[model samples]
Target: MKHLNSQSFLEDSLKRKVIFLTGKGGVGKTAVAWATALTLSRNKRKVRLISWSPFESFSEPTTLKSLGITWHQLEAAACFKEYALKTLKFEKFFDAVFENRVLKAFIEVAPGLSETVIAGKVWDLFDRGEQDTLVVDLPATGHALSFFKSPMGIEKMFATGFVHRQAGNICDMFVDPYTRVDIVTLPEEMPLVESGQFVEHLMGLGKFHLGFLWLNQCTPDLKVPDKIPSTLDKSIRECLEDHRFRLEREAKNLVEAKKMPLVVKKIPKFSSEAVKETIEQIAAHMEEK
Candidate 1:
């Protein structure tokens, strides 16, 4: 696999069939995913961006529609129903099985059932080879661990059967050359700590390859005067001090992050609040080679 840097990320994204974007909650991972998908779509590659939840304020479906990218929600129950229908190959049998209260209760409490089915859906989607790229905005930190590990759990639980086979396939796909994960994180202590630990666990699994570590909402290094005027007002001074503090934290975290064996890139805090502009900027940044 190519050792991808920020410069190569955008181009390399096209090379992968699936890219998962995940990080701590509220770190703008979704925006990065959308931008990546949008970039591919603009390049005339068929791209689909998958979300697990309903559209939040930032993810405007109309914008995706206008950009020629498909947006989809890959919910667990829905995907499970789809997979069961295909696997069982009989709608009546599916209804009969699901209609039984005991079976339904068993399904509700079954370990890894939801995650495996979701992973199965992902595998099925890729198996079809219908899209040029599938960009999944995966769940935040802890849930993401379960997302990738579900197949392994299922494989261990089922010694032989279609589910066993499917679980093994998902595991293979996890390490496939065409699949990778990119993480977005803030430079703050809590987020960085969580991200570092997450990376450790992820690498320990050895099932997935990390692509990029994106520093989101970053304040770019700027040439500021050595000191604020002595006459500056208290609030202004506070603001300047806050900016300086952020820069210091960013630098410290960046140094620590760079020590990791992965490419780290920063997505700067935007002056403009326009969602379209933010995505476009990130897309442009990712496209840099």
Candidate 2:
């Protein structure tokens, strides 16, 4: 069931050219990100789905190969090299200067460099107008905070160079009207708490358009029957009991989510495994007008 302020659920999410999905680890952000991308593609929106986290099963290439969406994984080393090439303005110049093994290793270990590279990459692609939409599955809450902070650091350090300019451009994407930072969460304790904390943190930073708080894997509410049919098998009864317990838990969590300052949109739980079809089901929900 949808929660408070759920109107325009898909519209508010899709209005942004770049939507960043983030939440606590294991909160199913990647699933929602892929599903949202799939919906965009099916609707004839040119979309690119990017993931910064480690390899996830949802990003399996074969599943998305026929979906008409461009899938990209942004690694620190590669993105940094791409940034270097753009700055140096020549492949030969980049190969000669940044070819050193020491610098390459540093790229992997540099603090917040991954975050910077990611923002820079997206900025370049958006500026180039390569696609109509970019759906990014960002790292968990803490890492995402670093991403929001990285560009300002780059601007301060370089002060006056290609890096500084690019950093400003990256920063621009954060406060831009078409950029969104959406949170995905399960109907549980820690995920809900962290979602609140993440928003509190955002308040102290640059103006970022807060989109929907995607309540992932919610169980559909069912009316409590006055009596259970004793004719059912024992194991089936046990499964029904479990379902009731989950519904109770989800109802309480939904109440908690509404208290937050963000609009809560829900995605009903589907298969036990997050397979290709699960994504397709979610895509359909996201396509709802």
Candidate 3:
């Protein structure tokens, strides 16, 4: 319910060891995640940005290293392999078991194993104290909800074992006050609706510490004089009217977003900037605020 400026919001969010940034697709969640990591690193915090991808290929942006933020791309298979090695305690045994063709295939097709392992790896990082902060760029709303819920499902399914224990630990982190989730979305109809629904869904789960909602790529409101220049062409006048309408729509969506449970922060539209520059600009905006 608080109207927080960017700096204060970032400070408060950093209190949580793990911050998950997620919302509908194409809402600039990854950009916000990178910005947050950069901002935290600039404050001298040891920060790590983790991006979840379902594919085999992974790459870290060189800009992250320049900002002093460690970056990791998490894939389910790799995470599962690491988790198995740690839990099984014998590299040889793990490789023999997980490397088998049929077993590997079965494990891959296992209902919630991948999701469980990914979530567990994140908790492992949080528990290991390897970094001051872990910023996760999660998938879209539906997949993210499933990712966070995987721990509980695994805990119930396993009942008693290392997997159960791991799931339980991750679930504990979920309910911890210091673990927060930030939902990011654009100031438009579909994203706003999904964000509101996502907030309600997280609340219904009764676990996560919903941190805030970010309204990204918001059009700035520009003032127009009552008396317009008569020399202006008709196309220019129409373009100005259209721009004003978009701004008004963005404002209305923002109002609706504020009605949700968490604080809402707006990121002005930066359409022309490259990825790295956009991240830096967002970080600067947070610093200034």
Itemize residue pairs with steric clashes in candidate 3.
none
lDDT against the true structure, each candidate: 0.79, 0.79, 0.80
Task: Tell me the tens digit of each residue's lDDT in model 1 across 160-250.
Answer: 8788888888888888888888889987778888888888888788757788888898897774567988799999888888888889879
Give one digit per residue, the lDDT tens place, for model 3 in 202-227.
77776677777888988765775566
lDDT of 3: 0.80
| Cα deviation of 212, candidate 3, in Å | 1.8
lDDT of 2 by residue, 1-289 (tens): 3222345756665566898889998877877888889887787778999888632334577777866668988877778787777777767544756668898777767766777888888888888878888998888898888888888677776668776777888888887888877899999988999998898788577777787888998887666565667898999788788888898888898999987766788888886584677888888877774
Model 1, C-alpha of 118: deviation from truth (Å)? 0.8
The regions of model 3 sitting more than 4 angstroms off are 1-7, 56-60, 93-96, 226-231
Q: Roughly what TM-score does model 1 have, to 2 decimal places?
A: 0.87
At residue 34, give the lDDT of candidate 1.
Answer: 87
